[model samples]
Target: MLQNWKKIMLLAIPSLISFATATLTGTVSLIMVGDLGFVVIAVVGVTNIIMYNAFAIFSGIGHTVNYLVAQNYGAGDMKKGIERTYLAFYMCIIFALLIALVGWTMSSELLRWIGGPKSGNLVNVGTEYLEIRFYAMSFGIISFAFHGFLRGIGSTTLSMVIALISNLIMIFLVYALTFGTLGFPNLGLRGTGLAILIGEAIQVAICAYVYFFVLNKRFATRILVRIKWPEFRLLAFESGKLGMQEFSLSLSMFIFTVFVARLGERALAANEIALNVMSFGFMPAFAFGATATILVGQYVGQGKAILGRRAGTDTAILGTIFLILLGTAEFFFAEQIARIYSNDVQVYELAAYLIKISAFLQIFDGLLNFFAGGLRGLGDTTFLLFISLAVSWLLFVPLSYLFIFVLGWGSLGAWLALYTFLAVFGLAVTFRFYRTDWSAVKLREASPH
Candidate 1:
């Protein structure tokens, strides 16, 4: 058990660091934009929320590459594995371009709707910032392809390296270009967009080079493989299901925020601060979940149902214990955590209170991620989708409406709604995993031409 836990941690840590790096860069970018004044900050913040939610949805589709590749590679079908990688890569590019086009054309209109009729400069500035940012997603999704391939093959180190490279460059470029320093042009908000575009382009070049190099040296697979569009139909369909499921998470957050926003600016701001505090642990739970996905997926592909089952069960145990420790730290240091984000007495006090509440979320969140990860390996996403839709909107949303508006619980009520949601949703996911036999599951592979 100790050795198994060690194995899981070894795989999990690099992914965790990689996630943390990406998030840290985003935080730094937000802070840099904040320096330009509050209006700029607000526009950028709203744009980020929209951008994040969209990316979350589409990236869910891209993860089809990871799921398909892991199973095929584990079953010793390298050709099919490589085939899926390319097909998914092509699919993501098409989707990225489609997203870019739609976002670009509708940028002004979307911002207008979001900001309302009276939103003048806010909508205009956001439209410009958001349009430019959409172009970056093309390269970002391309890198996701490389990441999925590497992760599917159980090599996570290079993904971390690529993440560091892209995000570190983004940090440097966003700083230089935003401030007119280091001979880089100061285009202000536009600079942030250009920086992301350049960083992701660099990411694509390096990721492409590394993927092929690894392919030749490690896997010894043919460098050139062909894909049939017809064969990719099933992959795309299944991936779209996953995309909707992932999108629901962001939708839930937005809905939850709306409910909180009604309580006024203080509640909203405090809620944001509390979320930032919560994120310190969220990334790790996600990392552990991804690790479980890779391991369990691989084992199931290899026809070792019993081993896969045990691995997932043990992973959930180990992940819960670690999160419990992290939650304890959050509980003890809630005040310090809230203070890091804001110093407003009422704001920080409310935020600190929310952080204490969020401490419970760490455990529930870990369970959701871990079990969900295991289920992803089983290609059980359709079932998970139904659960996300049913529990998130039906239970959580209404509960928030009841607690906040009717009971006048304010933000406290909303947090309780979220707390209730996570517990039920997390346990529901856990139950699905335990009750099912996943070993018999394997995805159909496309014939490499």
Candidate 2:
């Protein structure tokens, strides 16, 4: 158990750092653009929610690839692992193009629907940002796929390094382009979008180098030379199912955000601040969740069902500990943290309240993330898909409506609904984890056609 804990932490901490860096990048954006006022902040927040919903579809491919690669590698099938990576890469390109085309064509309409004409400049700003950012989907998706591949092979440190460097470049470019510093144009929100694009493109380049030259040399694996149609179809089908799960979750959040937006710009901006701050505390759980997935998948692949279960248990323990400590800090410093994002007194006060709410829910949040990853790693995605859809759509959305609309609880009411959803979802997944025989599940056997 101790050794498993050590191993999980070794992989997970770097993953945590990578995820934290990504979260901080967005925090910096909010901080830098906070001066643009509540409307602009709200616009960025809405755009981010939409972007993530779209990206979640392709990100599912990365998660699926991670499970496949880790299982194959653990089973001493290096060639199969390499093949899975190539298939994921190809699928990523196709999906990226499709997602971009759809986003580009519908950005204006979507923003208008969310923000309405009364949103004034917010709609136009968000639309333009989405249109520009959609063009970077290919690069971002490719980078994510490579990150998943590396994580599966126990090279999370490489992914961390790439994420760190790429995010640093984004921060610098955002400052320069937003303020017309370093001989760049003062493009404001558009500059923020451009910086994200260039940064993702650089990450893609770095990942390509690592995948082709570094990893190839280290693992003695060859690049994509052939397509395996059967395996390709299976990967696509599994990823698509997982993608639908992600899409459902994102859609729920998007709907929730739309409700928040209806409360006005201040409410939306405050919600964004609260979410970002909550992300910091969530990072440890997120990392541990990814750790659970990799370790459990690999152990199950090696036919050690008990070891796979042990890995998940150990990860949940560690994640709970980390989140408890972080949540304590968040509870005490909620106001200060909120102040970092905006000078608006109302926004900060509301953000602080939401942060306190989030602080109390951290443990349940950790449980949900850790177990969800464990289930995914065990090739139990169907259950996760069903449960997530049920909770998000049936329970969460309705409760949110009742709290915010019917009862007039506003943001606090919306958050209370979120807390209830996470608590229920966490318990459900945890029960499933203990009760189910995940060891008998085989990815290849479960493959569609």
Candidate 3:
């Protein structure tokens, strides 16, 4: 038990660091742009939510890479793992091109669907921002895909290094370009978007180098030469299903954000601050969940179903404890944290209240985050996806609309709605984790190779 704990920590901490860098990048960017006022902050927040959901397709697809690579690694098929990793890269490129094409053409329509005319100007600004960022989707998606692939095969540290370096570059670029420092144009929100694009492009370059020169060197030259179409299709189908699950979750967030937008600009701005602060605390669970997926998948592959179950449960407990500490800090330091992003007294007050709600719900939040990951690792995505959709849309969104919009409870009500949803969903996922025989659904047939 002690040994397993140690192993999970070792893998998860770095993964957490990588995931945290993304939120940190956004937080710092928001703080810099906070001076632009509430609308700008709100716009960025909305854009972040949209961007995450947009990326969910790739992230969901990447799960296929993780499952396959981890399983292959455990089965002692290093060659098969490498082949799947390469295929994921190719598919990400293809998918990213499609995203760029569609997003560029449909940016206004999408924003209109979510934010309406009152937010139309903000949406326009965000669209321009997304346009610049979309150019790099291919690189970003491929980087993410390879990151999952490598991490699944127990090379999580490599992904961490790439993420850290990419985040540092984004920060520096944002400062340099947004402020017109270092001879770059001061693009503001657009500049921030540009920085994200360039940084992701750099990450893709790094991933390619590692995969082609480093990882490929470790495998045979023949495997490196081949791009197996049948295997690619198999992985893509599985990934597409997972991606749809991810899409549903992200889409739910999009809907919820739109609901907040409807509560007026102040509410929108407050939600942004509250969400960012909450992200800082929830990151550990995401990291731990990533580790659980890898470890659990590997265990299942190695025919050790009992070990996989134990790993999932143990990781969940550790994640809960870690989040509790974070939640406590957020509860006590809510005002201090809110002040970091907003000088408006009203925005600060509202954000603080929301953060308190979020802090109290951290344990529930962790359970939901890690359990979903654990279940995914065990190839239980069928149940996981349906549950996520049901909980987020049917329960969370409905309650949010009722309490915040209908009851006139404002930001407090919105937070309360989220808390309620997390509590219910978390418990259900926990029960499923304890009761389900996850290992029974292992990939019975090999992805065509």
Q: Quick one: best TM-score, which candidate?
A: 2
Q: Each candidate: what lDDT?
A: 0.77, 0.86, 0.81
Residue runs of model 2 more than 4 Å from their true location after superposition: 443-449
RMSD of each: 2.8, 1.5, 2.0
- Per-residue CA lDDT of candidate 2, range 1-449, in tens? 78877898899999999999999898998899888888888988988888888888778899898888888767878778888888888888887789779867988888888876466667667788888788767678888889988888878898899999999999999898877888999999899889999999999999988888887876665654487678887788779888888888889889999898889889999999999889887798789999988988888778776788888999999999999999999999999999988999999999999999899697888899899998888878889889989999999999999999999999999999988988999999999999987647664533444
* Tens-place lDDT digits, model 3, residues 1-449: 89989998888888888989988988998998898788888878887787778788777768878877777777677777777777776778788888788768976667666676586667756778767666756567778888888778888888999899989999899888777888889888888888988998899889878876787667652354366677767777778778888887788778888888887777788999999999987798788888888887888778776788889988988888889888999999999999999999999999998899789687787888788777777777777778888988899889989998799887788788888888888888888888986547464244455
> Each candidate's TM vs. the true structure?
0.90, 0.97, 0.95
Which regions of candidate 3 deviate over 4 angstroms?
A: 221-230, 438-444, 447-449
lDDT of 2 at 158: 87
* lDDT of candidate model 2 versus the reference: 0.86
Ranking by lDDT: 2, 3, 1
Candidate 1 matches the true fold with a TM-score of 0.90
- The alpha-carbon deviation from the true structure for residue 277 of candidate 1, after best TM-score superposition, in angstroms, is 2.8
lDDT of 1 by residue, 1-449 (tens): 88888888888888888888887777677667755644565466556666667787777655677777778777888777777777777778888888789777987876665555445766767777888887887677778778878888888887898899889999999999888898888889889888888998899999888877756676654456576665677677768887888778777876776566556545655776677667767777878888888887788778775676778888888777778887899899998876665556777799899999889676888889898988887778899889988987899889999999999999889889988988898999999998996646665554444
- Against the hidden true structure, what lDDT does model 1 obtain? 0.77
Model 1: CA > 4 A from native: 36-42, 115-121, 220-224, 261-266, 342-347, 442-449
Sliding window of 10 residues with minimal summed lDDT for model 2: 439-448
